[model samples]
Target: MRIRPITRDEITELVDDLWLPFAGEMGDIDEYDALAEDVDVRAEALDYRRTQLDDDETQTFVAVSDDELVGYTTVAYSESPPVFARDSGAKVKDLYVAPEARGEGLGTSLLERAHEWGRDRGCARISLSVHARNDAARSCYESMGYETRYVKMDRPL
Candidate 1:
């Protein structure tokens, strides 16, 4: 497998493909339909990510094997909201490895490349958020030396 920076034209396909599994994974929850109700919202979100990719502050990397796209990741400077304390580091916004590629080290390889990209930008830390129910992903992150720093809880009103 090999890792490289994402190309400009690959953004749409990358974002769209990742959302498929993401939505499927969350479909088990009752709130998923409500959250995914607006198709336009999905398009807008992809557009937003496309725009961000043009910014120097954000970077995306892809992992390839046998000339096929196997995994991809996106990292950016952590945003600091005035109301909440945020650390100064590169925040991994997305990381996805094709289900068939899970056992391989593609995810870890992508993350390591992200760290090098962060270090090149003078970032002091690397962070990411994973859904509580995604135990496999959580375990992978933990095994890679990541720790939980924050949690957001939700419930039906």
Candidate 2:
């Protein structure tokens, strides 16, 4: 298995692979289902990724095994607000691994690449969001030394 920056030719496949994670989220959370019903997520993701392909501040990485795309992650650099001590940080927009590919360390490998990318760009911190109910993902991130810096609470209307 290898993890590398996604190529233009592989964008469609990457978008297609996104369904695995999206579907899981939709099934696991009511909010995700409501949101997905309101938008064409696949198209939005494709366009979002395409725009980042040439942008220096953003990067999308894919994990391939046996010539098949198995996982992906997107990271972006941004400056913190004036209130923060750190000037800049990197945020992971998305990260997913296929069910069959889970437990093989693809997620960690992809994140490690994101770390390298952020470090190369002089980012002071790296951040990502995992759904509150995504226990597996939260556990994995916690094991990797990620700590929660904020909590987003919602009261459904």
TM-score of each: 0.82, 0.89
State each model's CA lDDT, in order.
0.78, 0.86
Q: Estimate, for each residue in 103-134, the C-alpha lDDT of model 1 and write its tens digit.
A: 88888899999999888877778999787777
Task: Compute the lDDT of residue 127 as modeled in candidate 2.
Answer: 97
lDDT of 2 by residue, 41-145 (tens): 778877877898989899999999999999888999998999977669999988988889999888899999999999999998999988888888898899899
Model 2, residue 116: C-alpha shift (Å)? 0.7
Off by over 4 Å in 1: 28-35, 79-87
Question: How many collisions per candidate?
Answer: 0, 0
How much is 104 displaced in model 2, in angstroms?
1.0
